[model samples]
Target: MKKIAIFENQYHQVKIQFEVANKIFFNDMLEYHQFNSSQDYTPISNISEFNLVIIDISLSSNSDKDGFDLIEEILIQNNPPKILILTGNSNIKENLKKRNLPDLPILMKPIDPIDIKDNLSKLLV
Candidate 1:
């Protein structure tokens, strides 16, 4: 079973992505995503246990750079899962450049399963 983590801020967006993932996946998968810190969407024992993490790089919480903060936190960990960023903002590439982080794989919003599938294939491969 592929363990996938989706770090997203919005409820409806997570629902949409989950639906898309479900279409391509079966019940054996263990999926997770970030929601309000108060609520646990999918209980994870360890962050590093995931096979892949799909992050939405939108402004969330109190920080304008919350997405980057999350990425940095994950990258700091030992053997972090494969990471992907999803964003509607085009300036995100420039933002990554300013921070000196590599241009990580990204998928724009209004995404189809094929787009997600393609990138996942490349990133996981």
Candidate 2:
């Protein structure tokens, strides 16, 4: 079984993404962990435990704790999971570049279900 952790501030958006992930994989094969707005993304010690990580661009205050922060944090670990950046902002790549993160595949909001599936399939497979 593969673990997939998702960090999203909005409850409704997280709910929708979970449904999409569930549709893509069998329930037994994939375990999903969800973090709400207030929580930090640093708890999980072993990055290997999660095969994929989907992070929302605006988390909590939106001033701090954005998706780029989570990505930077994860990159410190040995073998970081494949990241799927879901952002409402169109300039997410620019924001990430400002933070000096690697060129990551970012999915813009409102995310298309097919695009999500297609991207995840490419990464996870």
Candidates in order have lDDT scores of: 0.68, 0.72
RMSD of each: 3.6, 2.7
lDDT measured at residue 123 in model 2 versus the true structure, 0 to 100: 73
Cα error, candidate 2, residue 22 (Å)? 2.7
Please, what are the lDDT tens digits per residue for candidate 2 over residues 14-125? 4666576567654446677777642444564576678998888777784356667667878888888998887788887788788898888877777765766677767777
In terms of lDDT, the poorest run of 10 residues in model 2 is: 36-45
> Model 2: runs farther than 4 Å from truth?
24-28, 37-42, 62-64
- Clash list (residue pairs), candidate 1: none
Q: Give candidate 1 misplaced runs (Cα > 4 Å).
A: 25-45, 62-65
lDDT of 1 by residue, 3-74 (tens): 777766674754665567556744325455555321233233366887887777764564344667667777
Scored by lDDT, the top model is 2
